[model samples]
Target: MTIRSSWSRAELGAFGEQVAVDHLQAAGFQIVCRNWRCRYGELDIVATDPASRTVVFVEVKTRSGDGFGGVAEAVTRDKLRRLRRLASLWLAGQDRGWAGVRIDVIGVRVGNSPAPELTHVVGVG
Candidate 1:
């Protein structure tokens, strides 16, 4: 595999988002959208959990190393607050209704192994 350090931040994030998407799909979630953006911010991935019939808003953080902090730590309470608002905005634009809504965080760490490492925190909101 190519070295993670060689990739730019955008590239790394894009790769990580793809990884997160694949992981979610494998875990039985139906992907609704990826990289949903608005004036306030962006939602990395949006999915529907078939079992729960809920809309899932995902935030993905990608890092080559823990120089700053763990990938999950990149998302703070303030960030989650903003995410809730963003999720509302996204939900407003949707035509279908969900049983409930949830916010999740997926952290991707690369460069140390042959494949990327992912951590999923469900119902963070």
Candidate 2:
């Protein structure tokens, strides 16, 4: 396995998103979309939790190291606000009824280890 420390910032981010997707799928989430974007911003992943019949909007944050802060700290209040707006835009474009909507954040920490550390925060906003 390739460690996160070897990748560039952009590559680390993309790798983290893929890891997040895999984690969600393993947790029984059906992926609806990936990298959905608009004028507002971008959503990393859109998934449905079959058990609760809810639409989940996911934001992915990745860091090769924690020099600045931990991966979770990267998600600021402004980010959450933007995510909420983006979620509204997504809902507006949807025709089906959703039981509910939620915002989640996946934080990935990449280092010299073979596998990166992943932290999932649910219903963050």
Candidate 3:
């Protein structure tokens, strides 16, 4: 049996996240924020869904292989709570609150392909 390494997995995950962001842009999501970090947590991407007129808080997860778990599995209840708190801080800093607020997840699988597979789960929370 071969033992996989953590660093390799992290690198692949990061690459997938980059692809996911590019996919989001191509899909007409205007990126309002990226990698917004606070003492509590970080938001991978914050975008505006034009059709819905909503502020989208995006959580990006990337996976190389599903042996351990899918990318979405990384987002736990505690993680969501932290994300919500960070989102609040972000909105407060911007001094802007629109009619709609949506939580989205962008899951990406990184591989040899030029464009990775992107699955966007909208209003997940």
Candidate 4:
């Protein structure tokens, strides 16, 4: 986990997405896409859990400090609703279907520390 002292919002967000992807792959999830976007919104990460045969939609929030409250506060109900709708739209374009679907959120906190912190919440909303 290399931590930089400074980062722009886009850089931080992209770095966080990569960190989230690494975490998910380590947990045995197969990554399907990153930054999947449509007319509705964006899905940070799309993956499949072979063990559960489920499709997972991930939203990543990267923060440099405590400015944003926490996981829940970072992802609001309206955001979750938009994610749900986005997930459905993404699924519609897929050629295959899964037995289940889930929403996950990964929060990446990067500051002047040596390493960034990560919080992964599964099945959000």
Winning candidate number (lDDT): 4
Better of 2 and 4 by TM-score: 4
Among residues 3 or more apart in sequence or in different chains, the pairs in candidate 3 whose N, CA or C atoms overlap within 3 Å are none
Candidate 2 lDDT tens digits, 1-125: 46633677778888899899999999999999999999988999999999999999999888777776865687799989999999999999999978989999888877746787898999998
Candidate 3, run of 10 with poorest lDDT: 1-10
For candidate 3, the clash count comes to: 0
- What value of lDDT does candidate 2 attain over all alpha carbons? 0.88
Local error of candidate 2 at 24, Å? 0.1
lDDT of each: 0.89, 0.88, 0.75, 0.90
Of the pair 3 and 4, which is ahead by lDDT?
4
Compare the candidates by TM-score and give the number of the best one. 4
TM-score against native, each model: 0.93, 0.93, 0.81, 0.96
Least well predicted 10-residue stretch by lDDT in candidate 1 = 1-10
lDDT of 3 by residue, 3-59 (tens): 223437667656766776777789887889788888887888898878767898989
- Give lDDT tens digits, candidate 4, residues 20-63: 99999999999999888888888999999999899999999998
> Which pairs of residues collide in model 2?
none
